[model samples]
Target: MGIILMFMLLASVTPFLFLQLKKTVFALVQTILLVGMWLYFFEVVFQAAPAAFSIPWIMFYASLFVAEVGWVMFIIRLIKTSSTVQESFQ
Candidate 1:
């Protein structure tokens, strides 16, 4: 439970860091963290007792979904922004 909460907190900050940080290494670290969080949540979902309707379980899945969406948006924005920069340079 503590670990899950910790991951939730970290996951919450990851998108902002991924989008705002200018450093490539920082973006890479955040991407790794995002993937790790998804895998950790996947394990929790599979190994936990059957309680799909429970409040905590629901929240966990909800957060996982939000994190995944954020990751996709981050990728799209990164590509769009990079392409615009390249176009401007050209």
Candidate 2:
């Protein structure tokens, strides 16, 4: 689905973009919180659970959400390590 594709693209590129743009940790935290909240909102929106599609495409999107969480955590760790290394070299 188009939404899944877009999410995949975002999940793949956002961390690198954040690093390149030297975005603040606060921004990343805000993004993660916003996404988690949005997902929770949608789960509530579909309170009855999703309908059974012939091919269950939604599963991929759900998995992508999990992957994105990992990506966010990885980015946070990357930021911490970079900052520590920079401080050490200074």
TM-score for every candidate vs. truth?
A: 0.51, 0.42
**Regions more than 4 Å wrong, model 1:** 1-12, 15-50
lDDT of 1 by residue, 1-90 (tens): 786677577667655755564545655555565655555567676876535665545555655565555566677888999999999999
Q: Model 2, range 1-90, lDDT digits (tens) per residue?
A: 467457655654554555554656634653564454445435545775445442233443444564576567667878999999999999
Top-lDDT structure, candidate number? 1
* Per-model RMSD to reference: 8.9, 10.1
